[model samples]
Target: MRLIPTEEQRELAATVRSFVAGRVPMARVREIAGSDEPYDRTAWTRLSSELGLAGLAVPEEHGGSGAGFGEVAAVLEELGAALAPVPYLSVAVAASLLVSLDAKDLLPGVASGEVVAVVARSDGPLPAGRIADRGAWVLEGVVERVPDGPSAGLLLVVASTGEGRRGVFAVEAGAPGLAVMPLTWFDTTRPMARVELGGVPARLLGESDSGAAIDRAADVASVLLAAEQLGGLRRCLDVIVEYAKLRVQFGRFVGSFQAVKHKLADMHCVLEQAESVVRYAVWAADEAPDELPEAAAFAASYLGRAYFQVARDHLLLHGGIGFTWEHDAHLYYKRAKADEVMFGAPRVHRARLAEALGLT
Candidate 1:
């Protein structure tokens, strides 16, 4: 079967690419990164409200486009190529955990860009003091490294119960005892935070036995991240390709040299492999429930490492300018680093893969 995008899908990508270029250029990204909001509200509104991107994957009944993961992947590719700093991943992917659970009432606000939601996870056991004792399920605990949490209007906090049950709780952004503080991070475009929850009113999502569903949501997020990373790696390669053709070293373009040509060829090969895996991952996200985790793991592990290497290689090819803040290479470099660990790091996904295959 052909993995190429359909005509309509190509149109969708072109539209998103043009929109992002017009609304959020590299200069705009730099401006927002230097701002104090921690996240860009205007850009988020443009994407979610004007572009309808926030609702791309939600059902029609819930005020979304009723599109599938493939459509979302297309949009994410454009977003990644531009390194556009919006909360699409947090609101579209993480908050989607609620959507998959059939939580429709929350979608209108979320899709309309009136609310921002984030997912919080960690490697260790879910901490105590994170769950609220009140009838409404009060949440109290600190979540480290929450993406877009500082500006999120809603939070989907994941915690474990005394009996080792995994639970997802919905907490309003402004509720009492909910605090979001920005963290110093390697990637400045995607701001992360340390979230503190205390006596925060929350509603439990799905049944207490919904750990399987939570895993599914994470799978979706991972697949989407892989697709995003693929786009970023391709963009990095594009930059190197352009640089190679233009930069003359010893009276010849760098691309004419054997070593540079081989490097670029390898980059192309890596990207093509990642592209196929991401396509499969997105397709599995929509159609193959049982295979979702495996698809996600394969895409995440390969794309994550591949994109990181592409970023470094792009910089190496660019030489001095790549190291400067003024150059766009560093921006993509930081994005690759950040995307590598988005839903779950490549290492974590590999471990999960081992468990799934009974090799652990």
Candidate 2:
């Protein structure tokens, strides 16, 4: 499979990069981070209407652009680099799950960016919450650390039914007996919340034993998130490399120092390797479905740690200023840490990779 972007993909990436750079610069990101709102709805609308980013991966029959995951991956990289405070992952990934389950009725709203949905599954081995079917389906229990939960209009909950079957249920954001409590997390760019359901009414989206669809969606999200981390990692490396070239230290450019040069070289090498892994994962998402499981596992496990390390090194290379809250370095550092654990931690994915390879 081609691991590199085509000309059209390159143009798409450049367009998204430029758009994010102009619209959601670091200053704008800081503004959103300090605001009470989780993300800028106006910007999100613009992305949907102007760029059609919300429908990048949805089928044409579903009011989407009919693009593949490669295009989605390209856009995600820019979003990650700019730390654009939008629910692309929450919405797009959820739409993917619904599509996989043949729940096309929900695709129009999601593809139009009118509905923001998040899967209320925790970062655990099993699905969260217990489901009951008393005349109609109802969910009762708590799901913690749901990404963009407070801002979501819909929640795709994974629950175990009375028949001991795992299924996905759609719950309205403001349904009675449902409480969404916002949580303070490390990354302000991506907000999270705790969802507590007390017999909240829900509609079943997929059949029982559709837990595999959730797992597939998580794999898709993991690969896309790794692409985002790669972008942030590249940005950190770029900023540091430029700073080293210009920052004068002890009568010479810091970059001229042998130690600094070696560090920069090592960082570049790692960045290239990480890019290869991310691109391969994205390709698997589009072209090679059978390889996607293992590819996603490897990308999630490797890129998370690789990106975090690069972010840490970038901070160190920037000296004391990087440690300050005012510097962008700290922002990327926090994002790295949060993303490292978002889908699943590196160790968790590594275990999955091992199991997928039949080692466990």
Candidate 3:
């Protein structure tokens, strides 16, 4: 498998990097972070209509370019670097799940970016009473911490029959008894919500038993989220290194010190290692599906801890300025911290990796 990105993929990354740098810079991100919506509508429109990024990896029949996940991963990295306040990752995860389930009706809307969807990664299946039966498909439960939940027009959940049967379900926006409360989270750039469904009607999107599909979705989410973290990690490395070069200490540049140089080198090594794992995970997503589980687990566990460490060093290396709320360093730190626990901590991922490798 090619761990290195193809030229086309590199171009895609550069294009997205340029677009985000010009349109949704750190200043714009800060503005969105302070708002309740926490996502840039205008930029989302442009990304959908102008760039067609929403459909980059979708099949042509589904109103997409029929590209691969590699392209999508590249775009995600750029978004992570800019800390763009958009629901791309959530949408990507939801759309990909729909695609695999062959939900023909919903894929078109998702690919065209007309239906914004987010996955509710609930820890357990909806209790027997929490979901109705006999073709009713009415759901009742609270899915806390749903990414982009407030902005999603559709919420996809994996619920079990409580008799061992599992299925993928969808709940439309404005459904009766459906409530989405925007959360005041640490990382406002990726806003979340507490979604409550009190007897809300839903539609089953796929087969009667969706255990494998649900597991695949988790692996997909892990790898994609790691992609975003990798981007943030790279940005931390860049900003910290630049600061070291410019800031003077004792009438000498901070970067010129041997100790500071070693620290920077260590961070660089971590960043490169993360990039390797993430790149391979993205490749495995499509080309080598069977290997994705192991790759995703490795990427998630490694990058989560790696990004947090680099982010912490990024802040400390900046001296007093990094700790200030006004500086962007703190924002990356928050993203790193939030991401580290996003999938129940790096140790959880390590355990998953071990299980997938048959070591447990």
Put down candidate 2 lDDT per residue, 1-360, tens digits, no spaces: 688898888899899888887888889889988899889898899898888888888898998988998999888888888889898878878888888888898988889898887888865433344435556777788888898887799999888765556788899889998999989898888899998888788888778778678778888989989988998999999999999989998999999999999999999999999999999999998999889999999999999998999999999999888899889998999999999998878999999999999999
Arranged by TM-score with the best first, the candidates are 3, 2, 1
**In model 1, which residue pairs have backbone atoms overlapping below 3 Å?**
130-140, 132-138
Cα lDDT of model 2 overall? 0.87
Give a tens-digit lDDT track for model 1, residues 278-353: 9988888888888888988888888888999999899888989889888988888888888788666788888888
Off by more than 4 A, model 3: 124-134
> lDDT of each structure?
0.81, 0.87, 0.87
Q: Measured by TM-score, how close is model 3 to the native structure?
A: 0.97
Report the Cα RMSD per candidate. 1.7, 1.6, 1.5
Residue 25, model 1, lDDT: 91
Poorest 10 consecutive residues by lDDT, candidate 1: 126-135
Q: Of the pair 1 and 2, which is ahead by TM-score?
A: 2
CA error at residue 352 for candidate 1, angstroms: 1.6
